[model samples]
Target: MADEVSDAGTVRADAWIWSVRLTKTRSQAASACRAGHVRVNGERVKPAHAVKAGDEIRVFHAGRERVVVVSKIVRKRVGPPVAATCFVDNTPPPPPREFVAPVAVRDRGTGRPTKRDRREMERLQGLGGDGPTAR
Candidate 1:
């Protein structure tokens, strides 16, 4: 909105990130900046850093990284539809999740495993050397 613009035609980094919907809250954006997770033009930035149209911003958050080029600047949070026009997303698709093997579980009443059982379980988990050698 016109009220969200500054005379310099730029907005604070955290505010812009929130306004564009890159983050759920401006505080989170600030924390990310403080943690060195927000970059502008490939250089780390602070929460108060000024961001203008055409700057490339990279944010690492929620276990994923987002790469976006600023298309517009707004200081007030906008709806998703309007927010989408505020940046050009260049983030790659998330990596596929690998299948994790199920962990071994004993019965509820089972007692502590014996040394042999421990060794066998360790072998199954690939944590120890090969199994018992031939006699």
Candidate 2:
């Protein structure tokens, strides 16, 4: 069942993605392929595209891109440990949260931001205008 590899030496791109736990569901994997968010060997592929071992897959989902090289092919969804062995993850680490711009938060019941407050919030977000008013 979960441990068995495909005897055909290849599987559908969408099925392989889900079986390897790259996406949450098989349907989501298919949708991603249809939306052109999945690529195989550097080319966009359909959901039914054949995926074999040693192929590189690039998927963009959940606001992040994942790049992995297929190490083993599985047709049925497997556990995390088994799924982990199916691919060689090549995705880079995400940027640190500290480097992200902080959102401006106002206390509950606070009225609309005053012009000065709006300007300050814009400055903090690096969206301030370059005109003299920005200084």
Candidate 3:
């Protein structure tokens, strides 16, 4: 067993996750527990749950859940890379966001057009080409 220091010489799992910026805040961590968004050792856990090194932890966020094993106990918010060191990612991150082409459109206006028409043109400036709406 590792001897972790705390205010009383011990650390809480929920607090640790909060300080580590895993879930934003301790209360939100607890809310995650209530919502069954967190698990330990393949079982659901509460905010007051106790965790030790080598334990498997999972967290849900942004429409996805992450699973990792406890490598060490840390009570400070570290950089992303350092935070990444806290555990091993069990699953790959979600797919990269990509823009999908919008449905075909027949733009309005004919002559010089109105100010709104010009703004619309700027908005669709990067859709591969000028598009059917382009002049």
lDDT of 2 by residue, 6-103 (tens): 43488999999999888999999999999999999999999999999899999998899999999988978899998898889999999999988799
Off by over 4 Å in 2: 1-3, 6-8, 129-135
**Number of backbone clashes in candidate 3:** 0
Q: Compared with the true structure, what per-residue lDDT tens digits does model 1 show for residues 93-113?
A: 876665555466777878999
> Going through the candidates in order, what is the number of backbone clashes in each?
0, 0, 0
Cα lDDT for residue 53, model 3?
68
Residue-level lDDT tens digits of model 3 in 1-135: 123322233246676667556787788878888788888888888777877767788888657787777776666656566667666668666666665544435455555656565556556664343567555
List of clashing residue pairs for candidate 3:
none
lDDT for 20 (candidate 3): 55
TM-score of each: 0.74, 0.88, 0.58
RMSD of 3: 8.2
Local accuracy by lDDT, each model: 0.85, 0.90, 0.67
Best by lDDT: 2
Q: Candidate 3: global Cα-lDDT?
A: 0.67
